[model samples]
Target: MIRFYHAPGTRGIRPIWLCEELGIDYGVEMIEFTKEFRASPAWRKISPLGKVPVLVDTADDLLMYESCAMVQYLLDRYGNGQLQPQLGTPEHAIYQQWNWFAESTFARPLGEIVNHGREFPGENLIPAVVAEMQNRGEQCAIAVGEAIADKAFILGDNFSAADINLGYSIMLAERFLSNGLPESIKPYWQRLSSRPAFIRATR
Candidate 1:
């Protein structure tokens, strides 16, 4: 069985949601979401940087730390041609683009906001820095809204893993952004959040 070392409300939701969508069996190993635990030698052995959502595929004796990579790995290895476009096609390129954008571009500022708050809390917190990150995150959200303006999903009518990828980042934006999600994104957020798989995985 595939074992997922996870903490609640982390990137682990991405792969766990994919597994739910694909009906794949996996085990969840909840870990303490604390700096001390993450910095421990034992957890470091499993995850070099001590990140949550570490995936251990016992069947292949494989261990993965990156959440998006874990999503792609499960899709390619066990998805059976679901939740993705044909490889090497333009559609797949767009899919990959959005997947990377979801994490790298969209999630970057939100993560910075979080890190800034954690590292510089109380009087040391910088309002301008948080505001700047919020602006960047809002820009990313607007870009997503524009991309899905006339479509049900990022790639026109199809609901691919890109949605799953973006969904988690959007969830973070909703939590972090001071102004909250734009009106353009509310419907899309509702559509993605209402999925049974999403509900199950997140719950």
Candidate 2:
């Protein structure tokens, strides 16, 4: 069986939702949110940065960690291209673009906001940094709004792993942005989060 190691309410949610969306028979190991345990020698061998998502494919004796990669693995090996565009197509390129945008662009400032608040809860933390992060996060949200404008999903009428990737970041953005999600973004999130797979993965 496939194994998924994750922590609730973290980036791990992306892979969990992907697995659920795929309907693959897999085992999920819910690790607590603890930096110490993740950074320990044993854990560091698998994940260099003590991240929450680590996937072990016992069937193939494979060890992989990166949530986006896991989603790609599941889709490539098991999906039959159900939730993504056909490889090498123009739409596929768009899919890849949004997936990268989710993690690289949008999630960054949101994570900064979280880290700044978490690492320094009091006035010791610079309010300017937090505000700046929030501003950047909102900017990212605007780009998302433009991308998702009038579309039921990111890549148009179809639902894809890109949605899982982008939607999960949107989930975190909601918490990080003090201004809340833009009106345009809320419906997209509602559509993604309403999935049974999303609900199951979140719990």
Best by TM-score: 1
Q: Give a tens-digit lDDT track for model 1, residues 1-203.
A: 88899988889999999999999999998999998999999999999998888999988999999999999999999999999999999999999999999999999999899889989999999999999999999999999999889999998887999999999999999999999999899899999999999999988
Q: Give the number of colliding residue pairs in candidate 2.
A: 0
Which 10-residue window of candidate 1 scores lowest in summed lDDT?
1-10
Name the best candidate (by lDDT).
Answer: 1
Compared with the true structure, what per-residue lDDT tens digits does model 2 show for residues 94-185? 99999998988988899888778778988779989989988988988889988889799999999999999998889988998888999979
Looking at candidate 2, the ten consecutive residues that score lowest on lDDT are 30-39
